[model samples]
Target: MDETTTAGPAPATTVGPAPVGPAPAGTAPVGPAPAGTAVAAESGGWLELLADDCSPGDIQRLRAALLAGADDATRRRVESEAQLAETIRARLADRGRDARELRVRDDLVRRLASLRDSAGLLQEVVAQSRFLLGVDVAYIMLPTADGGRLRIDIVDGSLGDTLQGVVLRDGEGLGGEVMRSGRPLWSESYLDDGRLRRVRSVDSIAVSEHLGGILGVPLRFGRSTLGVLLAADRRPRRFSDHEVELLAGLAAHAAVALRNAQLFEENQRAVADLRQSNEALKRTDELRRRAGELREQLTAEVLRGGGIPEVGRAVARAVGLPVQVLGADGARLDAGPGTDDIDVVAVTGSAPERWLSGQEPASRTAIGRDHLAVVPIRMRDGCAGCLVAVSDVRIGDETVRLLEIGAMTAALVVATERSVAEAELRTRGAFVTALLAGDGDDAELRRRAVAADIDIDAIGVVVVLDNAGQDERAVAAAATRIAAELHGWVAQHADRFVVLARQHDVASVRARIAALGDGDLPAAGGIAPAAGGVAAVRTAHEAARQTAAVLLALKLPGAVATAAEVGPYRSLFSHAGRDDIAAFVEAALGPVLAYDRARGRDLATTLEAFLGQSQHHARTCEQLCIHPNTLYQRLERIGELLGTGWREPGRTLQLQLALHLRGLAQTLAPDVGRRGNTP
Candidate 1:
């Protein structure tokens, strides 16, 4: 068995004293040893020479001189002590080397425990491996993906990349054998080792690296082998069993480190994934919470009978973007807080057809410098309108859902409004129609009119709309809206619109309605003089109808001809009004003449009866033996036939003078003018 343990075999201890040559020059001068001084070898110079530290040559020379004179027994004892001293010196040297090797191995183990990842751990293992075993180079080979071969994973103290990514197959080299057997294998001279089946590529690499000796051990964990850990030298050398054991121990540590590194990486990845999932859950929860709150808010709006404006405001507050609502016709019905800053007209024009008819599903469409997101306001009939959100940036999918909820509520509100509006129009339209037909009792009719938001006491007179032959339904809708704004009511009667306006002046009421919403209003209308009572309202309706016919006959479309603006001389008027005395008569009597031609009854007679009696209705009714309503209707017809200017004081004088001239011309006979009698 080997007594000394270090990386290599220790020098063997010599059994005898070293041969003593001529005295070294530094030795103390020695007289030729006094031959006759025969000191005992056992006690005399030997003990003193041993006690005092002296050169081996001086000590040996002294023993030789003394022993020459002493017995042979003394000489033998001196040789025995010298041999023991030489053995002790060899053992001391080996003890120092062992101490150093142990320190290096301990440091490698400490560093291996500190590694954190597989790649870094493998690199540190190979580097420390070279130092611990005192080899020229070190490397580690891990099994390839298929485990059919081992590829060099890491290398330390290498001169080039010749062996990098190099593979060792089974039965190909010493590294391959270690991988197959899962055991330690080494050789004193790698090139000469017939035990290893060398491959051409590995052999060339080995020669290029100047490698002669090699040692490798399998990195084993439990029962399975991971790879090979190898150390090599550039010159031939014998690797002792102790060196082999040390390398195997390191390989064991490397295997454990590799496994630990893999587990550590997996744990880190798991933690990162968990953190990301947690953040996503938090975001999802936040969005759900916001959606719930907005839904409740919008539901409250619908339940409370809130309309589009209210719904728009609630959604705007939630989404921080402008919102607007439009009717099925794309008219602006209501706008929210931020809508004033947006181009409402542009938004309406660019809107998708789905807003009205829901032809397609909702999505985002880009408008100039803005984006529009719409949700159809679905109704029982079809899509009634749309709820729109305008933003400079794109709206997210979550916010789109919130807007959809708002649109749903808006649909309910709009549907309710439409139902109520239709019912109201029916009730009010019937009431106004009956009152104009002179059918209901005055007191009962007045009460019913009040219920329909019409103060019958405040109604002055009625105006009949010709509607310019436009759509009667559309015309009635516009007329009803105007009546509501004017605090009155509208009636649809036989393709003509009769509105009982509450205002005092017919011209003011006409202008007011034109301002209200006239896009669908008639271009022509006729007004009667201010009157009250159901009987008087009936006469007013006839007068308005006659004036509207006169306007139509005169080709005065878009003109509101009223009974208070014309004179009796309109029966003598002409086709065109120009700057002549004849033109003045033409402008004054044109509508009255047209009325007589169309109605086949002369309003010229009614004009003469009212204006000829100095605007006094009772005297005219007495002279004609007609009712007071008949006298009032004739005077009002004069105003309606001659449109606009004839009701003025100066205009009335011109009309009166014109009527007087026509009377004189009628009284004088054509024979009197032919006989040259100037009358």
Candidate 2:
């Protein structure tokens, strides 16, 4: 309340506590007792005065006399009794206050739910603040448009009219301070308080109103303070801690209720405007009848758990035109019955979204003596899709409006479906994550799998996908899609995306995963055969992740393979000596040698020439004294026989090094190079 204007000099005010004043007239031991009065009270003479229900003054005098003459033990007993009595009184008072506060909060919640508009809610909050505290005035200060000042929005109590619509400038009053600090502040004799900065215009109003005691609490909604809820008194009175608490609680409730009511009003206004526009556009009886029928059918479909298919049919029937529902990605979700004749070429080629650039809710394009219109299906998440309508002639505004109604219905159904799908996905993801992490005992794992409707025993393959510079959301999306397709679940244990699939063929599973990208793996993956219980699953998950890392380390970014496929090379990086190197080279070269021996082919010589010639077909051909065509055919045959993985740079490097070892062995030891297939 900014009422600081005063015409004359203000009355002197006591700032903190009640001022000391002359004592009230009373019988202060008018007649003096005998000299032994203080001493005689020790034996029980003073106690008899209490049996007569003595006056307050007489009891005070008697009590003082006993305490003055009492020994140390007696004084201690008296003090303890006084302390216990004070504690009891405080506790009882607290109980009453707590009960009152609970009742007020409950009432506020109920009132908020019942409030239909912002003004009514604000008015109720202010009134409750004043009545609950029995203060002289209560009001809320809301920030102005420019936010440089606050205006008194609503007030209650007889003194409130003086404050309504008063503008409080920045740094002028306690209201602004409370708002800025987001904490409650109170002052006795606010007009005379020296600690607070005062503006002449606001202070003058305070003086004129004779406002004294004031308390302000920030009206907070979420992290922001919308305004200040303040209570002021006409007398220089000190507000208690309990009173401050009560006002603050009310302010919190008011903030939430005000915001809710604001949103509600905005929605109501929008709906009303839409309804009015619809009525104005209602031109003929037949059209009105059809629109009404469409509304009912669409509403019933949504209410009865319908989806795009149901919604599409109703709109098509009402408009006597074909309708198609497209998903967010422009994929066909569903088409109405007899919608085979829809202009697929026109609709697919045209961007329906571009047509929505103007003020119209929907737009259309000509289709060779026919028309196709689309209304965007806006759901809570975003634009979920569009409703495409085809007509024998140009589309009309009324038909477009009907399509919008259908779009709205379709959005609701799609949103509900999406929500359910998302919830299921979360449940599945969590289950798979727990399963992979071995979070629970065997029984618990089985129970979780059963609840998620998953068959634990059907699982045969575990694959881990590498993020490896992929968008996290995109990686997750791919994992979820593949997991669903495979009748399994995806879990992200740290950065690796693990998919537990039902298929047992690791190679076939890798093939499916490869299709997710263009012709290679969507992500570098490690595939392992899954079996056993928690321990086996955990071991396989670790192995799969290890394999994926090895693939990445080998510079095979878009490849999926098992750990054993690269185990020999992996050993080359570990604690392996000459024997290990010899064994690896033989292992790497033996396949080609054996195939050549069996088929009488030159695959081994071709691979040796290719590697020795730095994989140049012309150079290898010239070195081998063969034609380029022959070199190519031999290289292809070598690739098939050895499965060399020559395209991978790391694999090629390993083969090159192994070829060097073979050459050295031929020079140093005559029989070493002939161990697999002799010349």
Best by lDDT: 2
lDDT, candidate 1, at 558: 56
Ten-residue stretch with the least lDDT total in model 2: 1-10
- In model 2, the Cα lDDT at residue 467 comes to 48
Best by TM-score: 1
TM-score of 1: 0.41
Question: Which pairs in model 2 have colliding backbones?
Answer: 3-205, 3-206, 4-202, 4-203, 4-204, 4-205, 4-206, 5-204, 5-205, 5-208
Q: What is the lDDT of residue 677 in candidate 1?
A: 16
Q: Write the per-residue lDDT of candidate 1 for residues 1-679, one digit (tens) a residue.
A: 2111211233321111223233334443245533322342445544454344333433445656544665668667755654443344335445655676667667877887788878888988888777766778899998898979889979998889887888989767999999888889998899999999889888899899999789999999899898899999898977777778878988898898787777888999999999999987987798788878887998887788777898889988887778877766565668566677766457546445544555555666666777778777777766777777888787777677778777888887877886787687678767766776565699988888778876766668677777545765556656666666667667766557777777777777767755654432454667775567667777776667656545554456557767655433233232232124455555667678678889896776666666678777778788788898876676578677776777677877877765554553343223122221111
Worst 10 residues of 1 by lDDT: 670-679
For model 1, which pairs clash? 562-640, 563-639, 563-640, 565-639, 566-639, 570-589, 573-589, 574-586
C-alpha lDDT of candidate 2 relative to the true structure: 0.70
Q: Candidate 1 — what's its lDDT? A: 0.69
